[model samples]
Target: MGNNKSLRDMQAEVDQYISQFKEGYFSPLAMLARLSEELGELSREVNHFYGEKPKKSSEKENTVEEELADMLFVVICFANSLNIDLQKAHDAVMHKFNTRDKDRWTRIGEEGEDENGNN
Candidate 1:
């Protein structure tokens, strides 16, 4: 379950897996709903583990890590269905954050200076 596969590889893997099914991929709206559902499940796990809420004995135990993987699977499926390259998307997002929001947070080591020596 744990590997160093890139986003492109993950997308291909999901595509291959979904290709075997007669239903292939769901509509974007349905996938969006599934993504939301997975997010809710992840949130519930977080609340149960970190917040005041505790799981009852009758409830099935699920780890936050597992919930995150479930959400990732749905995301990969959504991206594959839409012909979107998540690697490029991730790179664009990182570039935006690095440039537009670089100064939005405080640096760890120095005042008014980031780890990359940018002031």
Candidate 2:
């Protein structure tokens, strides 16, 4: 959810930010560990908001969107270090989903109306 930039553009921005640092991207293992940590943070937020669990008064609150952005930054760093194009990766997965699950779910308008209660 960056404004309007493509994934490639986002990758370039991440690269520029990382380039300023003396130590660039972390090792792959470290990147994975960081991703896991961010994911856990996001999960905790989700649990507090939507699940039975409640956040403790001492705990700080973070939006799910912010946690997702943090994870995305780490992922972009990982992909940039490996010279992988996330746009291509995302497209390939979307292609698979479109082909393999073309009819797996019903469309909102297929039932003669949109999900928004519109005609």
lDDT per residue as tens, model 2, 12-50: 999999999999899999999999999999899889888
Query: What's the residue-level lDDT of 36 in candidate 1?
Result: 100
| RMSD to the hidden true structure, all candidates | 3.1, 5.0
Clashing residue pairs in candidate 2 (N, C-alpha, C atoms within 3 angstroms): none
State the C-alpha lDDT per candidate: 0.94, 0.90
| Candidate 1 Cα outliers beyond 4 Å, as residue runs | 111-119
What tens digits encode model 1's per-residue C-alpha lDDT throughout 1-119? 35899999899899999999999999999999999999999999999999999999999999999999999999999999999999999999999999999878886676877568778
The per-residue C-alpha lDDT of model 1 at residue 80 equals 91
What are the TM-scores, per candidate, against the unseen true structure?
A: 0.90, 0.84
Output candidate 2 Cα RMSD. 5.0
**Full-model lDDT, candidate 2:** 0.90
